[model samples]
Target: MSALPYPPPPELGWYDEDATVMPQQTAETQPAANAQPVASAGTTTAANPPTTAEIAQTTAQPTTASQDDDDIDWEGTVLSTAFTASAPKQEYELYNEQTGQRIIVDTGVLLGRKPSQDLPQGVKAVKLDDPTRTISRNHAAISFDKDGLLWIEDYDSLNGTYIIRDNTETKVEHERMRLQAPCTIRIGDQFFTFEQR
Candidate 1:
């Protein structure tokens, strides 16, 4: 399971691979410079930036997908897989227990502040409203796999990601964790419950 690669965070946006940055500078503070400051990825140089050819190969769009549904007005995140008539089709409803908000999810979802807006072809992301500022820009992801299973993946967020069920709270570890409906998902202070539709 290869996760998509997004630009580091807004705090780190000032540092691009081409615009060199001095080693003494940190993410929080930057001084005015006449020349564009480039960020060095260890030995990376402005002459040779990393290419997205590798990323595109890994996160390519699926050959077959359904975009006819407009009831939810949001297309599910379609993972790269072979779609077949025998594939199981299951939809889940993500409800905000606190706000009574309902979100119907079938394909996959990238949850954070504002994801994919910057990426030209990145997977469309669902914006998570977090005035508390605990969630990262690309905080977590929910993907329905080809095998008809749901998985939750954490993006190494600052605070953390977790799943709670049966009165026991379990953290979403580094790897993607399998998720069952009728459970609560916590990204930072926000909480949402999922049930099969």
Candidate 2:
């Protein structure tokens, strides 16, 4: 099997191949004759003044899809846990491999963030064996397992747990499920998605 908790790199977009051409420069666009070329570690000449395209390329924000195989963005670092009996506020703390930084997330207020969606009617996620449970009690303790596996245990709910893969859904009617990276889990009506960092 392929590596768990990781999505394959996106296919190259059309712009990639077309944008590799060398940009042009002209004397009219060059700096005034009186300006001194900044000196660096070595001798310099005006034969190759940087172009706007070059500067834009140097200073441009790197696209997430352009990342190397080993690089990861915030979306790739998603981690989550689900609950059945108790509904504690959901929380997430993720690392950005590209930036080497940490990010904190609170699920309760997460709706204010981007990528919002409305819950579907009559579709709810719940803990297994908890009849009194409502769609609200989905709580989980999320941490990366030693093997890099994600362990999501049902705290005990009525309707049980459901996991979604490739748009196909599977119900969890047991104590817990060992989640791999880049999987989606649903508790009651709420949905949570995670990916590798």
Candidate 3:
């Protein structure tokens, strides 16, 4: 029998009539005509994304003040005024036992070695200058809460803060404790008495 003839080899050229040519698809290339483009990570799709005109319109709109007169709640204001009026009208006085100096704390008081210039609007600074330098520059603070209750907080003092009540001394740090009248507060070697006036 005669040997079978081999098929012809494929044409190798830029333009081959019988060869099937396919375009390469790459990340940098545009998508096919009928293929839907994909959105990258964290990117919004064109189907529901905001248009440039909409974004510009939103940005061009003028902003009004958040607190308008019509938005005020008169009932809430009346209730707040009533609560404040019912609260006690008591004041506290801090007297240094050793130095014989007094500070009348109407709102709040900050006790330290040197006077603090950046104290809050209603807070007073009382200087406790010691010859031994045991007290910190910002040692302690005394404030009255909304309910007219006194509170004492130690401002991370080196020697610590002590509250002496009824012959007992309790060290306080980091947290504000309820301070009663006729109690002594000891910061380093200086002692101050909190009395109600």
Top lDDT prediction, candidate number: 3
Q: Which lDDT tens digits does candidate 3 get at residues 10-112?
A: 5554343323555576866866778876877545577969678867877897654433432455434555655656446777787886788788887888888
Which residue pairs collide in model 1, if any? 19-37, 19-38, 20-37, 20-38, 21-38, 77-108
Candidate 1 RMSD to the correct structure:
25.9
Task: Highest TM-score: give the candidate number.
Answer: 3
lDDT of 1 at 10: 58
Over 92-170, each residue of candidate 1 has an lDDT whose tens digit, in order, gives: 8877766566777776788886765663342357887776788888998888766878899998888788999998999
RMSD values, in order shown = 25.9, 22.2, 21.7
Between prediction 2 and prediction 3, the one with superior TM-score is 3
Query: Tens-digit lDDT track for model 2 on 1-197?
Result: 98678876665454555456555658877788899877674334587777787677667857555655335555576565432233433444433343333433332211111212343442223222223243334443343333334455554555445778888887765665765656666655445555544
In model 2, what lDDT does residue 44 have?
42
Candidate 3 residue-wise lDDT at 129: 60
lDDT of each: 0.74, 0.48, 0.79
* Candidate 1 global CA lDDT score: 0.74
When sorted by lDDT, best at the front, the candidate numbers are 3, 1, 2
Instruction: Mark the regions of model 3 whose C-alpha exceeds 4 Å error after superposition.
Output: 1-87
**Number of backbone clashes in candidate 1:** 6
- Clash pairs, model 3 backbone: none
